[model samples]
Target: MMSSFMRKSLGQFLATLMVIAALAVTSMPARADALDDARAAGLVGERADGYVALVDSNAPANVKNLVKDINDKRRVAYQKIAAEKGVPVEQIGAITAEKIIREILQPGMYYMDATGAWKTK
Candidate 1:
């Protein structure tokens, strides 16, 4: 039989593990689904120039906020890359956007044109 102290420690460890597993299962899908749903619904689209754009002016508040959050994160990433490479932030953004559009965009998703129009691919 295990000592009382060992049993208590084991229970605590198991509880912590359960919490971590629960979080991992629940948190990841919501973020991915938010973006996927927003794109599918035409609320947001990838731009040819290498940024996200609001496709629908009347999109829901959550979708609009999501776009802003993603764009903000992208800006930070672009800044980091630009500093590392000694290039302009806009240049980094443009290059990254091109690569995302070309390699990461999936079929039947929405994307923006150079003329500021949304198109489905």
Candidate 2:
């Protein structure tokens, strides 16, 4: 039903939009309280592999969903950075996780070690 030129143009436009969306999502700051509150409540913690994990198995549904949302966003950002740096996503996550554990984690915050044990920093 559409001409070749129109289809090509639409394809390019969609691709551009996807790139813009990805950039926007990656650049935007995380929403407040969603993660911080969960962490403070001992519902979620950072994993040594650079992902969010449930510290309390009995955490609320909202807290679990929050962890999934944050980790999904992080995966997208990591993929973008990995592509730009020509490195594996796992490497980026590992390095990022180390930095997070060493620098970003605050006192009294929880994080999981490589052995899957929860530790408070």
Candidate 3:
């Protein structure tokens, strides 16, 4: 028969092993072509998250630099627009970024074009 202390230690070790296995399973990557499969299944949240992950993981140095440049330009543009429209710069940034992301993710045109590209409704 095992000592009481040894039994408790063994139980704790097994519990820890189970918790580690659970965590590993939860964080495992999806199967290959998982993004395509998710899109086919109409899993928008999964697809978007997967796409964002892919872009973040595989983006080149130059593209990452370009995105930073674009964001800097956007900050300047937001400040100018906010000043002209008498709106708070933070509010302008929030609303404009939302609208731009929405338009790109789900296309449509509004009165003011963020990209200056005339998009038809």
Candidate 4:
């Protein structure tokens, strides 16, 4: 017995999940591995807004480039999902963040919390 708002929220979350699944399947393994390596090396982190970010301001240029490239692709995916679901991109981002931080991110990886502070989990 879900309220209308709850039902709508659930529907949007499900749509976001489908988009994320599609992105995971379509993403190149080499690029995904590079992002994984950077996270393991503490060079980059996951933002709360479904984007990859630099962990350190002094991270190497290559790490910065990798984050930028991955984030650009993610933004496009989020926008597409948001439009199809009639939800805000930020909402897509938050749902994606939940899956990433809770499921995808490895133990040593860094992720931003609700307060926008990066934490290792």
Candidate 5:
């Protein structure tokens, strides 16, 4: 029931919103814990080597594709986490790195940095 002008205006507004969303996604930061940092953070450190070995063990094509797919999914997941945490998207990498360390890293492994520290939960 809308007029043509109204529909055109609405379409333009939606296009603008899409452009803005794309820009936001592309401009977001790219820093995240490599698996090592997660271990250092006391998360899953014990299993780090084993995980890597599994990845290196001539994984099937589907497994490799799944890994790539998961890595892409992690970006969106971390973006939501950043928004929820009230941190800039650019800083989400560091925050998530710490989270991985705390949540995933295992104990009794050496993951020291030059600063020689870990934030224990």
Candidate 6:
């Protein structure tokens, strides 16, 4: 179990990481036919689990593949962080999702809230 000091340190660490992640997402250069494009075009949406999902069930193969690839990477990252911090991977992911939704999501972008419904940012 984490001590009080360790929990405080972890909280600070997560806050800093969230800011960095938000800045990274916001500062990225947009590329054609990429994640940004997919998001802007309403082809995809962010989930409360810190992963991207297709807004439409009939989205193209490319969108599916992109979501799969990105989510896979995120899962790996979350797992690493969770193991290091002795926390559940889902907790890390949910925290990350909160940051992304509040700081990184742009107007017209879609995200799933706690009710499992997609809403525009």
TM-score of each model, in listed order: 0.69, 0.73, 0.39, 0.89, 0.34, 0.79
TM-score of 2: 0.73
Candidate 1: clashing pairs of residues: none
Cα TM-score of candidate 6: 0.79
Candidate 1, lDDT over the whole model: 0.66
lDDT of 2 by residue, 1-121 (tens): 9998998656544433443355356543554356777777777888976688999999989888877777887788768766765556786667667766777677888999888899999
Q: Where in model 6 is the C-alpha error above 4 Å? A: 1-6, 9-33
Clashes of each: 0, 0, 0, 0, 9, 0
In order of lDDT, best first, we have 4, 6, 2, 1, 5, 3
Best model per TM-score: 4
Deviating ranges (above 4 Å) for candidate 5: 1-58, 83-86, 107-121
**Alpha-carbon local distance difference test for all models:** 0.66, 0.72, 0.39, 0.85, 0.41, 0.77
Candidates 3 and 6 compared by lDDT, better number: 6
**Candidate 4 lDDT, 37-61, residue by residue in tens:** 9999988888888888888889988
Over 28-73, each residue of candidate 3 has an lDDT whose tens digit, in order, gives 2543244323323323111211111113335455444443443454
**TM-score rank, highest first?**
4, 6, 2, 1, 3, 5
**Per-residue error at 42 for model 3, in Å?**
17
Compose the digit string of candidate 6's lDDT tens values, residues 1-121: 9999998777757754953464355433543248788889899989998888999888899888888877776777777767766777787788778877888788999999899999999
Best-fitting candidate, scored by lDDT: 4
The lDDT of model 3 is 0.39
Model 6 residue 16 lDDT?
41
**Model 5 / residue 72 / CA error / Å:** 2.0
lDDT of 1 by residue, 11-88 (tens): 544433433343234335776588778887777888865567788889989988888776766666656555655556
